[model samples]
Target: MSKKVIYGIFDDEEILLNSVKEVRSNGIVIKEVYSPFPIHGLDHVLGLKRTRLAIAAFIYGAIGCVTAIWLTYYIMILDWPMNIGGKPSFAYYLSMPAFVPVIFEMTVLFSAHLMVITYLFKCKLFPGQKSSSPDPRTTDDRFLIEIESDDEKKISSILNKTGVTEINVKEIS
Candidate 1:
């Protein structure tokens, strides 16, 4: 069965929380929420699990570190083997100071780029993908609750009962 999202917009945080409670108490499933800024306790209100994006970023950063180390070592010590002055060419410990900048850069580069890519992939937000957002205003100054439902009448009733300021329906086809 295809699912669609019905959204309710609210201005007050208290009203938003109350609406969420009311809808959930009625056994309706909320798909997601959008807010202009992070709302205190909203994640708990929505029963959302913590994201693992940081963990993924850490792993990607570690991969970048290893890659940078291997590449630098291979190029500086093995491939060219240039001895500057009396310093040893393959001095891994002595050359560590020079490697610090490259290592740091690689770590940041990999973590940032990979995290963005992973987040987009996880949310199915690829290029040309059309996802339903209730209203553009919701991104600016309103709080939005997006719920999955098929019964329009029931959804409208819930929104009315919850004191929603505005509402919109979007089919995710």
Candidate 2:
């Protein structure tokens, strides 16, 4: 069935939070919430699952470290080895300390860049990506809660009682 969404626009974070709780407690399904700033405890109220970005970051960092080790070993110890500062160029263990900075920097670089890319991809955001927020005010000073249900009467009653300043109803494809 094509769903009709109701957006309860709120003027304050506290009111939005309270309204979310009230609506959900009454057996209504909230599709999404938009806010100008982060709302503390909102995730808990929404029952969102924990993110796995940390695990992905760790794997990216491991890959970077391994790449750094192989590149350093191949260049410094095998391919045209240089007698840098009169240090032994034949043994990688002897030049291990010199490669520590490179390894650390590569690890941080790979993790940060890859993690951000992954986040952007997961969110379906890229250059020139069109936004989906129905009201532009949700990105500025307002908080919006989108509710999905077939009962318009119940939805309006709940939203009106919960201090919603503006309400917009739309059937989106």
Candidate 3:
């Protein structure tokens, strides 16, 4: 089934932000918003939930830390025990200082790489993927508010009062 969407275009970020708050206050649901650059406080105005990517990154880093510890201990202490700098061959704690750098690096590397990959997948973004922006101009200097509604007149009436520079409505299949 196809759905109808109203695209409210604005030339200024301030107006866009205020419009979002006002429109939502009028009991309208905004599907999404697009902009040229980051607009501080827009998320709060739009009532968007905070992202939990930081939690995912922390978990990934922990996995990397554990893997690094296991790899270093097995190679240096168990698999090929070597006495370095008078430290006991089998004493992991005795040479833990030497392993700190490796552990930290591994944790950072794992978290950064895995978080990026996960973000890409979450956004369905990759090389050669088709863009979904309703207006090409939004990438440069314009902002867009996408509202899905069945009553065109109702949505239009709301946006018209919100100082939108332009309004475009279309049906998506």
Candidate 4:
């Protein structure tokens, strides 16, 4: 099935922002907006919910911390029991200070790498994926707003008053 949508283009971020607000106020549902650079507060205006990536990062960090602690305990205390530098090898706590750096590094490494992977997966940005942008100019200096509406005349009238640079209609599946 294919749906017809209206695309409104703007040259300035400010104009796009204001136009978005006005369009929302008029009860038209905006499908998406594309811009070359992020415009602050656009997400808030779009009424998007906060992300849970931070929670995922914390969980990944905890996993790394636990893995590092287990590895250090198994290697230095249980398996080899090294007596290097005359450090106490009798108890894990006695040798914990030496393991602090490794633990911290592991935690940071897991959090950073896992978070990036999670983000890429969440965004569906796989290799060889085609772009979803409606207009090429939106990748440079233009802002494009997509609204799904079968009623073109009504949407065009509302968008025209918003001072759009150009308008185009497209059908998508």
Candidate 5:
């Protein structure tokens, strides 16, 4: 049997919320939601869990910090021990100001890059991956809801109840 997904298109936030409510009330499961802009309280309406990006970012930042400290200490103390202007080679305590820039840059670099990679991986958006978005216009001025089901009658009923502006169906091969 072919897997089917019902896509609903909307132009307004209120109508989107109402449509979600109606579809959910009918015991239909929403596969995904796409929106052009952030809609207030829409995540709550869809019962979506909050993203853990902040936590991941913190962990990545910590990794960056450790890497920076290790690299700086190894280079300054062991590899190339250079004393500039009578300053101690391992003057980490006194030369913290100089190291701050490196640490900050590494932290930002690691957090930003790692967070993006993790987010993309978690969202199943790997390189050369194709997503099944029915309407490209949903990325601009429309909202799209994808519901997984093969019951056309139930899908049509739900769409009618939710006042969906446009509807389409796609089969996953």
Candidate 6:
């Protein structure tokens, strides 16, 4: 099923930000806003909830830390015990300082790479995926706002006052 949506195109971020606030204050629901770059505080004005990517990063880092510890312990203490620098290979604690760099690197590696993968999956963005933006200009110098509403004239009037460069109406599935 397809529904009618109003697209308000703006040239400036400040105008777009103020327009969003004004639209929401007037009880108009905005579906999405597309921009070329991140606009600070737009999320707050849009009333979006905080993301959980930080928690995911911490968990991924923990897994990497544990894996590094296990790998070092198994290789140095269990698999092949080698006496180096007068330190006994059988005791993990005796040579734990040498594994600190490996542990830190592994934690950082997992946190960085896994967080990127998690973000890509969450956004459904992958190789060969077509763009979902309503206007190609939004990826350039324009900002586009998507609002699903049956009343077109009222929205168009309000958006016109908010300084939209152009307004377009379309049916979206």
Best by lDDT: 6
* Global local distance difference test of model 4: 0.91
Clashing pairs in 4: none
lDDT of 2: 0.90
Give the per-residue lDDT digits (tens) of candidate 4, residues 1-173.
45688999999999999899999998989999999998999998888888999999999999999999999999999998977877758889989999999999999999999999999999988899989997888889999999998888888888889899899997767
The sequence of per-residue lDDT tens digits that candidate 1 reaches over residues 68-173 is 8988888888788787786778767767788889989998999899999999999899889975665677668898898888886787788888899988877887
Worst 10 residues of 3 by lDDT: 82-91
Regions of candidate 3 where Cα sits further than 4 Å from its true position: 1-3, 85-88
Model 2: ten consecutive residues of lowest lDDT: 82-91
Q: List the residue pairs that clash in candidate 3.
A: none
Runs of candidate 5 with Cα error greater than 4 angstroms are 1-4, 170-173
Residue 111 displacement in candidate 6 (angstroms): 0.6
Please provide the root mean square deviation of candidate 5 (C-alpha atoms, Å): 2.6
Off by over 4 Å in 6: none
TM-score of 3: 0.93
Residue pairs with colliding backbones in model 2 are none
lDDT of 3 by residue, 1-173 (tens): 45789999999999999899888998989999999999999989998888888999999999999999999999998899986777766688977899999999999999999999999998899999998998999899999999998778877887788789999989977
- Candidates in order, TM-scores: namely 0.78, 0.93, 0.93, 0.93, 0.83, 0.93
Q: lDDT score of model 3? A: 0.91
Residue 13 CA error for candidate 1 (Å)? 2.9
**lDDT (tens digit, per residue) of candidate 6 on 1-173:** 45689999999999999999999999999999999999999999999999999999999999999999999999999999898878778688978999999999999999999999999999999999999998999889999999998888889999999899999999766
RMSD of each: 3.3, 1.7, 1.9, 1.8, 2.6, 1.8
State residue 134's C-alpha deviation in candidate 6, in Å: 1.0
For candidate 5, the per-residue lDDT at 166 reads 86
Error of 4 at 48 (Å): 0.7
